[model samples]
Target: MGLQPIGRRVAAACAVVISGTAMTLLLPGAAAADHTDPPCGPAADACINLSENLSWLMSDGDVTFGPVPVSHGKPGYETPPGVFQMSFKNRDHHSSIYDAPMPYSVFFNGDIAFHEGSVDQQSHGCVRLPHDAARTYFYDLEPGDVVEVVP
Candidate 1:
């Protein structure tokens, strides 16, 4: 057969095996693939570690950060995952529920936003934090920053 596209896995080499020692190196294969576009690193000053903080309740419709007030959903009905770009910013727009005005809205993954939301792990599946948490998250981020929503 001619050279056809075949799935290839670079076998784990003994020299590259991760051992009991602290060692940092560029990974092989898909290791370089950005989990989200624009590549979010804690050092980038634009990364938000969403997966580490909350759970995704696709059926419930919100997210909860302890001690932070609850927030409701945005206008759109779908929460997207994977790499997405921040579309816009809304500081005064009202949420669909709770009737409480949030101070910040960090829109990412298309219409999905990581804004001041309920601290209950609800919503279509967006990572929701409290007002202060959201402010801190958004404040540290600029437009066009990449966000990762992992399960």
Candidate 2:
């Protein structure tokens, strides 16, 4: 299939169990301003909340996955907040700058990407996600897809 804009895609809200409570996450459009809504608007395919360490996948203002755990850049090397389009993806990537492994990498902002790593630890600048989440992001998101990073 060719690239399709989020507004053209159809999807339904999903429910996920967090802690002990089952919560329903409804992805909202650009006009959404509810406190429960994700920081990123409907235009974004993926959204990251740095302070909460959470990420979500969305399609046409409908949640496709998450509110899942993630780890981002720590103190000095902070994950910048902005809306960006995905540039590329690498199933098995090697970081030349850090000389480390970055599996299922989905690059959105320069060298900073969403990659498989320990969610409990901080990264240099990338958004580190659990293995499953990273895999999902890598496969589900295409180049030119929008990604939002919020503080």
Candidate 3:
């Protein structure tokens, strides 16, 4: 079939509806269940090596992950790159970048943490991932473990 044209406004509305539906379908619900920690790392918490950075999360001696994209401080307030231990965690969190709710945040450093972030690079000093990825990171991170944030 020839290209079916949609007017600008109609196309935009359709986009919104489609996106909203997708979000609804993906939303975590009652059926969502917690995954037990794997017998060891290298599975869900397996650290993936990256050319730029290495991300990590530990649920206990038994959990951790790595090499995920994360945003750091804005122009002048850049996050210091180094090894730091996780200090805080919240399954339900409010983002500073956007008022929207972030389901998981594992603090690897004071004020600086890892959580779901806006679609674009937007954060003060937090490892931002897609919502699902952040949830996974949160579920896997444990307090007092090192999460290396690199430059």
Give the winner by TM-score: 2
Compose the digit string of candidate 2's lDDT tens values, residues 1-151: 1222343222223323455566644342211232345678889899999988888888766566676778999899999999999999999999999999999999999999999999889999999987766766777888999999999
Query: For this target, which candidate reaches the highest lDDT against the unseen true structure?
Result: 2
Cα-based TM-score, every candidate:
0.46, 0.77, 0.53
The whole-model lDDT of each prediction reads 0.43, 0.79, 0.49
Per-residue lDDT tens digits for candidate 3, residues 7-119, read 21111111112554464322121112333322324322223122233343333343323324445566666666665667889888776665666568777667767777763
In model 3, what is the error at residue 130, expressed in angstroms? Answer: 0.9
Error of 2 at 27 (Å): 16
Count of backbone clashes for each model? 12, 0, 5
RMSD of 2: 7.6
lDDT of 1 by residue, 1-151 (tens): 1111222111111124455886544332122332222223322322333433432211112111122233333347434445555666687656575555545776766545767766665565455666545654554455765454432
Better structure of 1 and 2 per TM-score: 2
RMSD of each: 15.8, 7.6, 13.6
